[model samples]
Target: MARQTPLNEAHRKLGARMVDFAGWDMPVQYSGIIDEHEAVRTAVGLFDVSHMGEVEFTGPGALETVNALISNDLARIADGQAVYAGLLDERGTFVDDVVAYRFSPERILICVNSSNREKDFAWMKAHAQGVAPVDRSDDYAQIAVQGPKAAGLVQRLTKTDVSKIGTYRFAEGEVAGVPSIISRTGYTGEDGFELYCAAKDAVALWDALLTEGQQDGVKPCGLGARDSLRTEMKYALYGNDIDDQHTALEAGLGWIVKLDKATFIGKEALVAQKAAGVKRKLVGFELTGNGIPRHGYAILKDGARVGEVTSGTKGPSVNKAIGIGYVPAELAAEGSTFDVDIRGRAVPAVVVKTPFYKKP
Candidate 1:
């Protein structure tokens, strides 16, 4: 049997179409994918992201232990700040991508993808020298309220002065009378807050927000909208766009790797790869014709397969078929032309700058 979130009943009450995602019964959409996607783009949309995992690190060696495990330098950010990072295996490939929240020198929280929760916890535990990471996945429920009008809607329920929290920052407070860690983070390429509250308070919180934000056109969004939103931003989806076989540098995530920092897992391998130069790079592209690119579609250059699409969609926001794929580093340049073999037809495409959609 698949696990269910605290808001599972709430989703069902609201007529959500549930599907099994990573062993969790999650809503794939409420009203419709395009409607929910547009709601998050122009107004606001609420997402039940309780399926994600959270692990807390504490004790004297917490800071050092966390810093050594991930790619980014957590020390660069102050308390209440979060940094996006990648967890790598010994071979320099991604074990998972995570966001580390620095609460204090002795305390930190790492939020990980739902599907990698168990594997990631084991990896962190085995590599931990002195500090142990405790899985808090069931202890909390997360709700992501996103879009242009998200802040205003959230501000009405929380007394924390939500306007003051900048991107990547969080604060501990009560939202809709429920205690929560209101973090300014989201998977969608929009300004929003990911509110983390106790599991038992999830239904109440969801009810309060939807009831209050009704007039503001807040829609109950789901996984389908989430996927399209992230795709439009070229944000990587773990199983689709990144995995254990690809290094951060090759995935266009080199910016998060701090090679100068103290030795961490995969450090030596990354240094060697950097010196050897990256052979392939991930790039974004737009189809020139009517075809929609899909995952695993062959990317052809000179009528031969040189790469393949990892994520693709007819962007709801951009109104075009866009995709992210890996190709020879030499062919990763902007304006580079290629063909995607979609349904045995060669569909022309061009490599373009990423972030297919940017907030105005």
Candidate 2:
């Protein structure tokens, strides 16, 4: 049996189509994938993301200890700020991609993917020389309100001036009388807020938000829409777009890897790879011909396999078949042409500028 999130029963009550995802029974969709996807694109949508894991660290050495494990520079941001970073193995491959919220010099919270919860906690614990990390995943339930109208909807329930909270910043306040962490963050490539409240308060918070946001057309969303939204933005998925077999640099996440920061777990390997140059690189592409690309599809040049697709879908917002894949660096430029092996037939595709969909 899979584990259930605090909002599991609520999801069932809402008639969500449930499926097993990384040992958790999660909703894949409610109304429909396309309807839910467009709800987020045009108006607002609420998502029960309570399965994501949170690990907290506190004490005098928290900053140093955390900075050493992640590739992003924690020193760059002040309190109430968060940063997207990669937790890497010694070989420079991702253990997981995470968001580190800096509450203070002595306190930090890391939000990790549910699929990698246990692995991430164990990895952090093993390297904890000065500060120990506590798994707090079960203590909270996270709700994401996403889209252009998301802020206005969330603002109805919170006392905090959410309009003043810039991107990647957060504040702690009460929402419908329940204490919560209101963070200006989201997985969808849109303006949104992710609220973290006590697990026990999840139902109340969910009900309150739905009631308040009804006028804004906030619909309940599911994992299917989440995957499509992230893919449209070219955001890498852990087991698919990125894995231990592939380094962050090769996965097009080199921007998050701050090699200049004090020695990190993968610094040496990354330095060596940087010097040697990345052999293959991840690139975004759109199908020029008919056919939707899917994961594991072979990417070919002159009918010979050169790479494979990582994530692909019929982009709901762009209304095009798009995908991300690994190819030799020499062929990663925009407008570069390649062929995708779709069920034994070669379909044409072209590398294009990433973020298949951008909010205007």
Candidate 3:
């Protein structure tokens, strides 16, 4: 049986259509993906992300211990700030993508992908130099309230002065009578907060937000919309656009990899690759002809296979069929054209500027 989140009963009661994802029984959709997708783009949407893993490091060396495992430099950001980074192996390839939150030198938290929870913990344990990591996945439940109107809706329930919490920052306060950590972050390309509260309080927190956000047309979203939203923004999804086989440089995530920082996992490999230059790069493209591109579809150059689609979907917000794929660096330029093998037919595609949907 797939594991269930703390909000599993609440999800079913709200008429969510559940699906197994990353070994968890989670909601795939409620009022359909399109409606939920538009709700987030136009108004507000709530997502149960409790299945995501949270690991912590304590002791004065907490920051130093985790900093050596990830590619980003946490020393660059001040307290109350979080950074999106990659957990890389010695080969400079992704172990997983994660968000590291810095509370202080004595404590830090890492939110990891659900599928990589155990693997990430084990990796950190084996690589840890002094401090040890503790798995806190079951200790908390996370709810993401996102959209243009999302902040207002969340602010209504919390007295934490949400406005003062700028993007990528977080604070601890009471929300709807529940003690919570309100992080101004989200996977959807919108301004919002991801509230982390005691697992026992998830249903109440989820209910309070939905009850209060109804006026703003906040809909309960699920993984389908979540996938589409991230794909539309060209945000790489682990196990899809990124994996151990692909280096961070090839995946276009070099900005998060700071070579000047202290020696960390994968630094040597990345430095070497940077000097040598990456051969293949991930690129975004739009289908010029009919048919929606799907993952694993072959990307062809001059009718010969050259690459494969990593993630693709018919974007609901942009109202266009878009996809991301890996291709030779020579073919990654704007206006470069290729063919995507859809089933068996070849469909013409053209590389375009990424972020298929931008705030208007």
Q: Candidate 3 versus the native: TM-score? A: 0.99
Residue 295, model 2, lDDT: 95
- Reference-based lDDT, each prediction: 0.94, 0.94, 0.95
Per-residue alpha-carbon lDDT of candidate 3 for residues 315-359, written as tens digits (9 for 90 to 100):
999999999999999999999999999999999999999888899
Q: Tell me the deviation in Å of residue 114 in model 3.
A: 0.2
In candidate 2, which residue pairs clash?
none
Per-model TM against the reference: 0.99, 0.99, 0.99
lDDT string for model 1 (1-360, tens) is 999999999999999999999999999999999999999999999999999999999988798899999999888899999999999988889999999999997998999999999999999999987789999999999999998888999899988998789999999999999999999999999999999999999999999999998988999999999999999999999998889988999999999899998878889999999999999999999999878999999999888999999999999999999999999999899999999999889999999988999776
The superposed Cα distance between candidate 2 and the true structure at residue 111, in angstroms, equals 0.3
Per-model root-mean-square deviation over C-alphas: 0.8, 0.8, 0.6
Mark the regions of model 2 whose C-alpha exceeds 4 Å error after superposition.
none
User: Best by lDDT, which number?
Assistant: 3
Cα lDDT over the full model 3 = 0.95
Give each model's clash number: 0, 0, 0
